[model samples]
Target: MSEDKSNRVVSGRVVSNAMDRTISVLVERRVKHPLYGKFLRRSMKLHAHDADNACNPGDWVRVEQCRPLSKTKCWRLVEIVEKAR
Candidate 1:
C-alpha cells in the first residue's frame, strides 16, 4: 500500500458522489448492547476523498485515515471493493 500502514482503514458503501472529487460513504457497525447482550446496528456518514471520482452510489469501498483535506474530510478512498449493480 502506498499510504502509511498505521492509519485507520474502514469499509463502507458510497452514498453519494455529487461533489467533485468527493464521495459520501455510509459506514455501518454492529455494537453490542451493554445491558441486554444484544447487537445493535449503528451507522455514520463519512466524507471521503476520491481523486478520480470513480465511486458511485452503492459501491463498496475502503477508506483510510489521512491528514485532513477539509473541515470534515480526513479519510481517502483506498479502493473500490465492489461496484454497484
Candidate 2:
C-alpha cells in the first residue's frame, strides 16, 4: 500500500534572508476577538529552509512542513508565489 502523508503549508512574505540557506517568513492572519467581534491581525515569524537561497525580502512564498531541519527551522521553501518589486 502506498501511503502518503501531507504536510502543512503556509504562505507568507519573506522578511529576512540573512542566514545561510535560511529565510524568515512573516505570516499574518486575521482573527476575531474573543469578547468583541473585532477583527485583528496577527503575525508570526517562521524560519524556513531555502535550499537554493532564492528568496528575498518581501517575496511571497509557500513553505511546507517537514522534519526539523534545525532548532527553529521545521519548514522548507516550496515555491515563490510572487516576487517583490
Largest TM-score belongs to which candidate? Answer: 2
Give candidate 2 misplaced runs (Cα > 4 Å): none
Candidate 1: list runs displaced more than 4 Å: 1-5
lDDT tens string, model 1, 62-85? Answer: 999899999999999999999999
Highest lDDT: give the candidate number.
Answer: 2
Q: Cα lDDT of model 1 overall?
A: 0.95
Error of 2 at 66 (Å): 0.6
lDDT of 2: 0.96
**TM-score per candidate, chains pooled:** 0.92, 0.93
How well does candidate 2 match the true structure in TM-score terms? 0.93
Candidate 2: minimum summed lDDT over ten consecutive residues — where? Answer: 1-10
